[model samples]
Target chain A: MAIIETADLRKVFRSVKRRPGVGGAIAALFSREYEEKAAVDGITMSLEAGELVGYLGPNGAGKSTTIKMLTGILVPTSGSISVADLVPHRQRLENAQNIGVVFGQRSQLYWDLPLRESFALLRSIYDVPRERFRENLDHFIEILDLDEFMDTPVRQLSLGERMRGDFAAAMLHDPKIVYLDEPTIGLDVVAKEAIREFITQLNRERGTTIILTTHDLADIERLARRVILIDDGTIIFDGPISRLREEYGTHRTLVITLADSYEDVQVEGADLESREGNVVRLRFDRRRTSAEALIRRAMERYALSDIAIVEPDIDSIVRRIYREGYTEGAIGSPS
Target chain B: MSVVFSRPRFRLEPYVEFAKVAMAKEATYRFDVFTNIASVLVRVYILRTVWVALYAHNAAPSELPLHAVITYSTIAMLMSLVMDIDQTRILRDSLHDGSIVLDFTKPMRVPLYFIANGTGEVLFHAVLMIPALALALFFVHIDVPSFGTLAVFLVSFLLGYSVGFCINFILNCTAFWTLEITAVQFIVTWITDLVGGELVPLVLFPAALQNVLVVLPFAAMFSTPLLIYVGHIPPAQYAGALGLQAFWLIALGAVSVVMWRLGARRLVSQGG
Candidate 1:
């Protein structure tokens, strides 16, 4: 059975019409008006058991809204959702036990107590058995390398340290379905790598189904086989990560080591994307012609010593999507 | 009815977990607790000094001895610790920071969580209060409660706690609709504590006012419960106090629960 399913999920929040400044404040003191804003607009998604899907979108693009609905934090204005055979908002407590959440910017750990105390508290909150709690704690502490700071107050820990502690606290209950919103946001390279590694291990070892929303493309590249790209409160694409690359991301750039100086080095079929020192970069879509073909043409024409192909990265793809889809005008596609 | 585990109830697990959270939180803010205890003590001293001068120096009527007034002041001081919720602060914080989203999703009952949170706070305050009372005992000839009086005190104390919790619940739900209504809650808390006897003895009120308070739960929440400890209200009056407390607790709890349901349905957060 599918672990999670939703049918046209939507959430509408009422915006109170408070007047501006002192005049609006006085009027609001006497009377208030409101308008309705649709936060999550008619979203429908389904995930099978044991599938780790990456949910990606810009801030306020309804990623958190969707997750909140899924976690039962906010009930939908319309439509239905079922997770683990229970309606999330209707059966919140049931979902809470089965699903764990980690908001990247927030700490779930008890800030005043030692990390161990927060773990112990969560053990009782989820009612994990004593042996199970100990087992999970040991594994988490070891994997997260928290042995040195297990006794430290959460308030005293570094952001990376605190994030690790939160990771442990969320896992103490041994929940089956995990929801991570930007879990690697604002982290050092080592910290981000550590978190990604832990997430990979948890899904592989424990069969924990994960729904991760991250700004880090490497996270998507590293762990997520499946990707769900959202924009303007709607899913624009949902397919394998590699498939996203294959479909809208086949363009690669050719960097040629110019044997000598050449001014106004422009190509018709291929664009002169960049030039630095003795090297010149030519970009062309693979569908139009392969990177090797472009490099061959450049070499035949210009005195080139060495050449290397650069694959299209997430930054370029997202920029292209935003520039074309979100803004005015479209990009020159495969043409 | 079997109260323990007849079903998969939200039970007291969250309460227990929240207790740890509160304790750990209190440990970090240990200074705040100390300052709070000092503030209560200062209020006690201010009231005690004024009343002592009124009775001992023949400045007031009825000759209610220094010890009697001191006992009244001490009881009011100790009870004040139990009544420091500041509902307005809670409501304002919840509305502003958007952390209320955390608990709104839980399968557990919302009002029950609020009550449990109050209980956690009471547990912490009760610890400091005991030592404060013990210290006051050394400096004053306060009347200690007998076995029967202590029993009445215990029952009435729980009732008082329920009353305070209900009032807080009703007041906090006001935040659902109102903008910046912390002043409203602060006023209500001050009136309840001062008028119902957290500043001085409720008996200091006019005879008519005391009679009116007898029928109200706010008085039962603070004054009536503490009177049993100070040996002012005898154990026999305990039944009447308990009866009044029961009526008010049931009435206020029911009203607050209804308000919570209505308020929650109308809750509109400004988040996407």
Candidate 2:
């Protein structure tokens, strides 16, 4: 059964229309005008327990709005949602007990207090059993390496250390589900990898359902097996990460460095894109022709010093999906 | 019936925990506490000297003599310190930075959480303000009230804090609509200072103005407690004054709740 489910969830934001300058401001006070913006327009998806799904979207694509609605921070304009068998907004406290949330841009811990104090406050807030709290704390501290600066004030910790602390803070209650929004944002490469490893281990060890929304494609590639693409407040694509490659990610690039300059280089099952000096670029469809076959043909035709085949990264595939709307074959593919 | 019975019991533990954390956080700013105490003493000294000079210039003694006025003013200043609601600024900053969304994710209601936190800060101020208050008493001729009156004053003071907190809470709710709260804060502070009877005793005002101001919630914040402390409000009127304070407490509490609900609906957190 799905631990989190939303059916046609929608949110419309209403904002007052203001004219420029003092005169416009005065006019607005007299006769008000409001503009309606659909921030999250009819999004529907479900996440099974222990499933890691990446909610991918460009800025202002309503990824955060959807997460907010699911976490009961913002009420949806319409539709239904169920997390852990309770309506998030109506049964907020119960839902809060079952789910943990973290935002990279904000620190939920107190700024002036040491991390240990903040964790203690959370323990009381969630009313976790003492033994269980200790167990979870010890587990996360060891995995995230939080003992080094556990007694330092949050304000004094570096952004990387603070994020590690936040992750541990969110999971201290042993919640069944966790929502991480841009958890790896503004971190060094080493810190990002450490966070990703912790997330993967948590899921594997505890069966924690993780729904992550992030602009960092690397986060999605490393942590999420399933991807849900959102655009303009709506779901554009939902499938496995590989399906994104299989459908829109069909083209692969081959770059060859030649031993000597050649005027005409021809190879079957591949189109020559460009050539400069001793280097040549070729594009091919993986479904239609194998890279090995094209390489053999290229070797037969031209003297090559080095050849490299590059598969399109998830970033480019997502960019393509955004550039060209999701094709029919890519829509609603089984994950 | 099952839904009602199964509903979780409202627990005070989390609020107490909030207070504990807030007090710990406030303890870190020891320098701020010292500065606050120093500022309060300086303000009291300046105001006390000004009141003495005014009374000396007037040949005909006022209804409240110089010593009584000085005592009332000092107590009012101390009450202001206890009733200070600086958490409004914290709430506004949280809203501005969009960290308020994290607040909403908590199991507790925002208003209650703020109140609990504010109460903790007030407790801290009260503990530290005692010495400054003691020093000020040595410099001024304060007529100590009877034990019964002192008890009444303490109760009124607590109610006044509630009223003050509600007013500030309502004002902070404006952050949901307007990003700038400084202007609103300035206006509210001006009104509170003028009519709350912190700077001048309400008894000295014209008869009609005094009557009107006494009924206002602003008077409940500072005037009521100060009046009780100085014996200006006799024991006979204690019940009526306490009743007025309770009325404003409930009225403002309801208004803040309504405002919070509306403001939360309109809350468009700036960032994702």
Candidate 3:
């Protein structure tokens, strides 16, 4: 059975549109307008145990909302969801007992408490036996490099240290599934890498099912095997990471360096996008011709200069979805 | 599920965690344990001066002694360390920053998490009060009467804390429905100080006011219970006052539990 599943799960919000000025504000106190926003419109997806998936989207794309529903933090406006046969937001305490969650933008540790104390508190909160608690603490302390900051209060640790601490805190309960929302939001590159590497290690070593949301493409590339892309509160694409790179319909950029500055260099099979002295930038379609073919054509035409190929990145793929619109990954893969 | 009482330090674990956090949190600020002690002492001294003037013309206090009144406010500062909670911030933060998502996914109930966190804060403040209470010993008048009175005082203080925590929790949990209520808390606290007998002993009030105050949960959470321990009330009356604090604790606790159930179902996980 799938570890997590959602069918047509939807959520909407009504925002008050109060008028401006003192008189309008007073009037709004009596009568105001409300605009409906579908934060998480009808959507469905399922995940198996031990699968590490990246849930991606632009700002306000319902990435958090979807995670909330799965984690039992949200009650959907319509449809149904089951994480381990329990409905989130209904059997909240039961649901909480079965899953673990991590929010990159927030710290779950007690701000006033020492890092070790926070762990000990979690140990009791989850009712972990002392033997098990000691074992888990030892493993977490070793893997996260927490010994240096273990005695420091949560409020005293640096953001990177706190992020590492939070990751360990979430996994303390030994739950079957884990949900992380932007677990690497504000950390430095090295810190982010550390957090990502830890998450990957958890999934591989422990077989813990993981759902992660992040804006950092490197996070998705390194950790998530499957990527779920979303835009405007709807899932635009969901498939293996390799598939996303394969179906990419956008053009690629190629830059060629001439032996010397070439004047009035007009090339065929590839358009000269930019020319600065000896270097010439070109735009071409991969489906239309291979890199070797395009380079050969350029060589015959432009004094046989050196060539460089730059494939489209994730940012442009996301931008294309916004501009041109997507059809297949709107909800998720069928069944 | 109740802790089987076999789990070692299970109950005390959260308190220990809170002490660490409180010290670290306090460390970040311009903190001197003496300054805090001085501030509390200053408040007590001013109140004592006022009471002395009022009693100069009148040699005797009503049923409540002048010494008892001083003792009441002297320990009243302990309430700040125990029950002065700000959990609405947690509820609001979870809703706003989406950390609540992480909490809801945990194996612990949401209200229990906040309660546990509050316990940590209280214990942290309790350690903080050691030196402060010691400093007040020199300038403040606190009569224990007997060692047995000290034990009774501890029991009464705990009951007061339970009621205080449960009441503040219900109010704080309401923020899940409508975001900010700092103003509401302020008004409720001021009323409790004025009429609930935190600032003045219930015995000092007129007969009609005293009756009304005792029947209400506010006094049960603050003054009447504390007075019971100081030998101000007859030992036979301990049962009735203890019953009041327990009843209110259960009542307020039930109300908070119901609100929590509703709030959890109504969870609308916002911004990522």
Correct interface contacts retained, every candidate: 0.34, 0.39, 0.51
TM-score of each: 0.88, 0.94, 0.82
Superposition error at A77 for model 1 (Å)? 1.2
CA RMSD, predictions in order: 4.0, 3.3, 5.3
Show the lowest summed lDDT stretch of 10 residues, model 1 chain A.
A326-335
Docking quality tier of model 2: acceptable
Residues B38-131, model 3: lDDT tens digits: 6777877888887777777786676657777777777776555445556334555666555665665555545555665566556656777787
Candidate number with the higher lDDT (1 or 2): 2
Residue-level lDDT of model 2, residues A286-312, one tens digit each, is: 877899999999898888999999888
Clashes of 2: 0
Q: For model 2, report DockQ.
A: 0.44
Which residue pairs come into collision in candidate 1? A93-B107
lDDT: which is higher, 2 or 3? 2
Q: For residues A224-299, what per-residue lDDT tens digits would candidate 3 score against the true structure?
A: 8798887877788889987776666446778888886666776666676888778888877666667888887778
Best by DockQ: 2
Instruction: Give, for candidate 3 chain B, the lowest lDDT window spanning 10 residues.
Output: B1-10
Clashing pairs in 3: A96-B106, A96-B107, A97-B107, A112-B21, A112-B22, A113-B21
Most lDDT-accurate candidate: 2
